[model samples]
Target chain A: MTSSTPASAWSRDDTGITVTVSGAWITSRLDQVGWPKAERSDIAGQVVVVDFQKIETLDSNGALVLHRWIEQLRKSAATVELRHPPAFYERITDAYAQSRTGATSPPTGRWGDSLAEIGHRAIDLAKATLHLLSFQGQIAVKLAQTLVRPRQLRAKSVVHHMQAAGVSALPIVGLLSFLLGVVTAYQGADQLARFGAQIFTVNVVGIGVLREMGALITAIVVAGRSASAFAAQIGTMKINEEIDAMRVIGLDPITVLVIPRVLALCLMFPFMVIFADALGILGGAIMATLALDISFGQFLRQFQTGVPILHFWVGLSKAPLFAMAIAAIGCQQGLMVGQDAASVGIRTTAAVVQAIFFVIVIDAGMSIFVSILGV
Target chain B: MPFIEQNFAEPKPEMMPAVRVRGLRTQFGAQVIHDNLDLTINRGEVFGLVGGSGTGKSVLVRTIIGLLRPAAGQIEVFGQNTQANSAAAQALRRQWGIMFQDGALFSSLTVSENIDVPLKEHTRLRAADRRAIIALKLQLAGLDPSAGAKYPAELSGGMRKRAGLARALALDPKIVFLDEPTAGLDPIGAAHFDQLVLDLQAALGLTVVMITHDLDSLYTACNRIGVILKKQLIAGTIAEISARPDPWINDYFNGPRGRAAAFAGAA
Candidate 1:
């Protein structure tokens, strides 16, 4: 990497300051020779002569550095002159210099820009909410119309989405529900042991898993997986103009794309909740038997007698609302994707966040409604 | 001193072409696109490459730029072997630029930021200098100065192509490879683009390898033309190659649209 290039240096002579630049001044070697910085005192009221006579090579980057350094010296009120430079230095730098005449530089970020961005985001959020509400109304109308003409439902696509959103989701849903059940039972048994009533842990596990944990955990997992998938798939299709193609061919994209996914999630969600309940109760029974000194038979008996059937229905009842919200948010974000690769990623993240947020909010509302009815 | 100085800006008067390909083979799996293809693009000339769809026009460009490895044979740019791992070969890379079809600009960056990308990476110039050069490049590509602030998605189709050209010219590359430079522009827009390429080539003394389907671009801009057929390249000047008895070449050059473009070029 070593070369016999002279280091660029400056010295004061009787005439003025002569800065000699030597070596290959191309981009690959510019850092080695380095640019000369002028102090105001050194060149105050003196003409600075930059001698480029000994420069071995020059490229665009080298010329730019020289041009900029000279501009800086002239700005400091020192006269700078170049001596015996290669013909290409002026040729390259002059082209860029000419472009500075009419060009507006990029805007720097300001406090006003930040405030405007916040205002824009607030408006975007309001618009998105309105869009989602309108989309939901459209879905409701389409669903009602499809119910009247069942053959228009695209049964094959619905079945495909069911298998995709439900059948493949079994292992994850089952495993997470079982773990939730175990944690609930173990924690309950420990707390109950302090009151000398460890056997009542069965009631805690049964009531908790059957009423809330089963539905909430399954919905969260599905929202994370299926919702993001739906957003990304539809977003890519929208970017490729496949959605436009379908519309031009007289096929309603809402009927063809949205209904099947929403219907699949709505129909399959209850079955997923029921499967989660059984596994969750099974996990609770195992934990009770091992930790609370209750036999599996005793745990089941307590779970059946202590937890009412209404509590199981209370959890199962929330599944359709959660599923619809998740699916709707996912589809809405997909439809909203702008024309870029970055927006697909942005919308997929928004789909998961909105779906999970709405799920929790809806669950809280449902809990209040059920409590008001004394269910 | 001249021999040892190694000045890239002033390429010495030499017989070497800007790009040289010898016995190059390219393939995807069992499907061979170019087999033992040889090409030579002279320095300081506008070279147009035309071929039927699925021919290896883009593939050859990719191989020459070291994006795709050649299955066999060699590629050289400015007399340096492209496949070499030497420091000199690495330095040789900065000498050329490529513009893909459809103006593949970075979706996140503004057009000026896009042009600034290579300069920022390869040079230590101050920020103001880089911005000045970005404005220069945008002007050279025949774009308005205000266009530098807009993202690629916001630009019109012709503007996007010009932006892509501006980015390619950012580093003042000696050789530029342009893939389908006028594929989607209107007729007038495409003609304006052809003139822009010719003007830039003349002003910068660039060796331009353009892959195009526009007969107007071929007639108006190119100093020579290369046609890919049956996995081989047939290359010569417009008059020389059009005189060949090849059926596709004859159909391509003497076709109605081709004749109209040729008449326009003559006018």
Candidate 2:
């Protein structure tokens, strides 16, 4: 098919330049022959002829390209005429002819557009934050109501969420905290070995893992995992009009959907933190025994004596706060999802990022408060 | 000239039907949907396939389009076997377009860009030329040119269906398959859509296969009707099929809604 087409060419004549095109001008063949161009300078003021007599095949794409070329020539002040065209040429050209003459160019991005966009985004963010805060207030009121009548809680849904957000998360959180403990103990042993104080590794691992790493690691993992999951699942339900149906059926989405998941995370998070702390300390002991030649009995004695019980309480207390922020942001983002599929993805991403950001911010604030009080 | 004339020209005995399905069998696991179904859609004719819900109307269309492999069958389009994985089958795909139910336009793209997708894939037309074609297609589909810039999510149901039609006709395909184009539309909108389908079919000389439950659509748009029953297809002209004594056909054509549509179509 490619070999059959003579390349479309133009010839000069006394009548004008006759742009002769031959062989299949169909879409597949057009790629090889390409759009035929006549020299604009030569035909600008002259009558140019588009001879379509020898054309073997012409589809809409071909006709469109021809019509576009003819329009371009006419725009250049050339009197463009079809010469020796077959009967079908008119039919094909007219079928694909553009009714809208002007191709409107997209608006160019001006410098002020960026500023305006930023302003718009800022307003949207502010509105979203206010909406989230009000939603939190609604959750608090609902929580109080549910407390008064505990039967209002959907126990099955709460159990399901506990399994998903808590049980399913155990392995990854445990693995990461254990690895964190091992690294902390190894690093502490290296530093203390220089001064023949390698026995201090137990105190370093116990203090670091119990006070900071355990709660922070568990919170970060849950924020990344459950936050995105919550946003996506609820956003899909919103898209499917399930939320609207729930409203019509007199079931509050906050009570039926959001609260159970949030409640489950709140109940489960402190346990996760405690579990992480135990595994982290165990990892530290193993690393100390292997690297510093410290006996398990000696490491336990040092940890019991050197690490304060207050450190465990400090970490465990932060768990519920972190869980609240993460679950709230996830559910809020899910409820905020727009009508389109792309918005679900955007909301899910926002849920994860904002949850992590808030968790870290809260941790920092708590750290400052703890430091000021010399905890 | 031959390419355009071939569409309107009477089919000689030597010419191939646009689509031919013979002894087709489709099953999902142990449950059979269609058994020994035979259907032939001639060139330049609007063929409507009607069946009750879950009667494998969609499954038949999907099997014919090679989206779902049939349990056993021979399906041919323009004399080329559709089941083959050869280059000819690839080229044959460009000869037809399928418009799914719900005007399944890409949610991310504007309507014009959705139309441009096929042109971009199948043709080497420049951006300017493709844009010109998109505007023309939008006009042909009974849409305003301004609608080209709006995304699918922005359009109403009727306009979205029109946009889907525009995209389907982007390459000027010889055959078009519409899956319930008029389903979920208001009476006026459905009538308008049927007229648009007829006008485009006449203008482009398309061989259209529409899977529709809309009796009004069958009455007005289709030249031939095929009813799927008892895992087999019974095909004939609308008048001929309506004449059958089968209880299902009798119920379908003589039902109150069907009678109203038939009367409306006649008037």
Candidate 3:
């Protein structure tokens, strides 16, 4: 077998210009060479022939490139023609050309059709936004009522949800935070050593983990794990008509399903933040002692002095808000699920994406507010 | 014209059954769905498989199509064992098509693209020829040409089913398996579908195995009925099977719904 890169050579004479393409004219060798550029003076109003008989192999991509070159030549009034192209290449190029032309020439009256479609989508988005706001208001009112009548709260269900979302999620959150802390400490040690301030690596790891990394990492992890789960579970129940069944029996699905999950997340987020914070600090301390020749006791001492108590409080304070956003987005998407198996999958994915996006936006807002307040 | 020879007929090679199953056993965990079941479906006929819910009617069809493995059984389709997964079995698969319940159309592709998938895989036809075939298939399946551009999610229940049927018939298979073809259609729509199936069967000489609980479909479309009861198949012409003394069979064919369907079919 011959192993050679694809190349094209062109020669011009009184009759015409002939371009011969050879070697593997396929996508894998697309980077090797391109078609040779012909001088306009040599081929002006002259017959041009592209010979593909010497080509070893050609695929769709190569055919498309060649087809475009031929089109360019014809557009320039060069009277171009292809010579001895393989049957498969001819078929593919012809098929692609037909589809391209067919797609480009839109049928009449399609403009009106597209305008109506855009109008429909705009209305749908507006309706969804309004519905989500109204749902949030309804949840606030329900929570207020529960606060007034304390006995209306489902305590057992709340506890169960807390265990599932918090206790069950502890291992993953701890492991991720520890890894984050170790990475930060190692990177900080290397950069600080270059500046002749290696001891200050402890402060970098300490303040960063406490003020931002710990809370952000835990929130993102919980959003991915628990938010999708909540959506899938409720969406499945909606599909089974269990939510409708509850409504028929005079029970509010929001009160029975959404409230417990939201309340549990709100109550558990602070505890998860504290656990994540401890693990993150411990990981930083271990990395510092092993690689930077700093003792564990010295690392802890620097952490205590360099990182203020307010930094820990600020990070902890973001947790409940992040948790509330994640829970609300998840349960709302689930409740809005349509009556099909496919909708469950769609809603679950939407829940995770929306939860993480909202968490990041909320964290940004909090950072700006705290900086303005100088806390 | 040949009465004596017809009475003592000899079986011809071309008249062999399309599908033959013997001693089929299907189970999930400790729950046995079918035990020692046997069935035969002849060529060039519409065979209706009827059973109550949870009776493994869908499982049996899936098993025969090699989607589910049987605990113990011999299932032969087009004279090749479907369980072997050999080249012959793979080739045999191209001879038949299965339309799942709920259409099961690819959610991403447009209707025309979905119908072209099998053609692209199995044939070397030109692009223009494939497009013409797609248009012809849409017309044959009773869909408008405009419907070819719509996604499966954008289609209504009836249109999705028609698009599914178009895809199933893309390869011009000799046999087609339909699961609950008329389950969610309106009466008029279902009747139109039945008539379409009948016309296509006669025109193309297709063998069909359909799972349906709709008694009207049984009376109007099926030439023979196979009832699943007590983990076994009792198959015959409708009249022959209805004459059996089984209590479930009696209730099924003689019940109010069944009788109304039978009367309506007669009318």
Candidate 4:
């Protein structure tokens, strides 16, 4: 085969055929002969082999044609051999295969499709905002109903929700927290002991636990667990038309459903934080006893000395704020739940993600404020 | 031909009507039911409304009691225009009661608690007085007094309906609208229910505007019958409706079921 517009290729067979791969004016020399790829080794046999002896340099398209030809030979029962294509041919072939599998797919114009989608999305968003605005009056009425009917958001109900979310979850929280403290203490003691500071592991563990990390961890766990609870409960109620029933009967669904939950969570979080802190400290004491050979009494003495009373207060302060934000975000998404029950699961998931995200953001801010205060 | 030469039970029009609906028009969407419909409900009267489904008999009574607002009409309760947004309109509403098809019983509250709701809302009665009144209404509705402590969920369909009725009468409403009050009941159950309605109407002097598909209810309980068809009312007794050759009227009163009613009356 030679590089020609009306191209050709030659086979060793007596009744041979010459095939050309041509596109526009420009064509490569290898186009005159179809490239060889994979084929069967013997006539009327299916054992595969590749023959590239008749073909030239393996540019990607040439290699592709060669592959096709070889595949055809392999499908039929025919013996084949390849002199192994030129280096350029192998390189182009490898590049093409890598691209086909890799992050870069042959451009099917997804980038253009994506841009068009974004434009359509922008228009849809604008329409939705306008639609939601018309419901502003309804929102105000709902809010008023929620606030005025304290019976709906009764203090009794808050206690019930808190008991389920906070009290019932106590066992898992306790187990996880005790292990976390033990791990922290063991790791921290080893590092501190290198500098003759094994006793300061009390300070290290105490400072970390009573400060942001302990509270942050607890909040994240509860945010994932409790916040989603609020969203799912309320979202399910909304879908069932139970919320509408409340409204028709002159009751405030939000106060009855949401306020109690938020209040309960706010009341519950600080206690959970305190419990977690205690468990974590106890865990550290166990680690300290085993690793540093420190007696429990001595560990207590070190802890008392290192972790000031003020640190406990600082840690305790973050719990209520964290709980409030988590519960608020959860209830908000729940109230925003759509008619479909599937949206209940979706909103609950969103609530958890959003609550944890805000917890981290707020934790960062808390750290800065605490540093400035020098507690 | 006069359809009512033989109305066994006739309305004495000399007495004051408890409700007077004039030119009532209730429109939802493009359709108008109660289009220029007029009806007068007399004191101590069980007024039966018979209609093909969706002819707006429900809408007519709903508009009169202000449960639904009529598009254009004068609903005068005790001679006061109910559409007027004055204290009188609400006062007129307070004078009458309505029982919806769904029971509309507050599901969250217990039966006793549900009965107490309207009393608590409107009356200055003390808790003890409210309890006594609620108990009386329960007994009057033929509900078991023991069932009072149970929530709506625990109660059967028949019990919920009775409990709902107890609540409707809690405020001592002078007029009561019962829409298909005996629906979904056996023959004997429906008969006892009809008797209960007649008793309540007599006892309370209530002018009952009852919308029912039950031909038996129309024959037995109603002092005056109004047929709603083609968005207009053909007002008279059952026999009056029977003789009217208006195809829809004939279909209602001279058709197979109508003939059976006439046969039963003769027997």
Output the number of the DockQ-best candidate: 2
Clashing pairs in 1: none
TM-score of chain A of each: 0.88, 0.89, 0.70, 0.62
What ranges in model 1 sit over 4 Å off? A1-25, A30-33, A37-61, A73-94, A105-121, A290-292, B1-15
Name the better of 2 and 4 by DockQ: 2
- Give the per-residue lDDT of model 3 (tens digit) for A1-375: 134677889987877888898887553354566558766566678898989888886644455556666777787646888899877666556555444442422356745898899999999999977886788788888888889987878899899999999999999999989988899999999999998887888888878888898899989999999999999999889977799999999988888899899999999998898888888888888999998899988887887787789999999989988998899888999998876677889999999998999899999999999999999
Candidate 1 chain B: worst 10 consecutive residues by lDDT?
B7-16
lDDT for position A155 in model 2? 96
Off by over 4 Å in 4: A1-375, B1-16, B261-267
Q: Where is the poorest 10-residue window by lDDT in model 3 chain B? A: B5-14
How high is the DockQ of candidate 4?
Answer: 0.01
Which candidate has the highest TM-score of all? Answer: 2
Q: What does candidate 4's lDDT look like per residue over A21-97, in tens digits? A: 23211112222342333233423453333434434323233344454445466565544444444564454344434
lDDT of 4: 0.71
**Which residue runs does candidate 2 get wrong by more than 4 Å?**
A1-21, A33-37, A49-51, A76-78, A83-98, A101-105, B1-14
lDDT of 1 at A275: 95
Cα lDDT tens digits for candidate 3, B127-231? 755665576567667787778898887898888888998898776677899999888999999998888789667755689999999899999999999999999
Task: Write candidate 4's Cα lDDT for B1-267 as tens digits.
Answer: 688887776344234478888887888989777688888777777888888888887878777777788888777777777778987676566667787765678766788898888777765545754655565667667776677787876777677778878788776666788888878877777777788788777555567888887777778888888888778787887777767778877877777887776676566
TM-scores for the candidates: 0.89, 0.92, 0.72, 0.44
lDDT of 2 by residue, A253-303 (tens): 999998998999999999999999999999999998887799999999998
Clashing pairs in 3: none
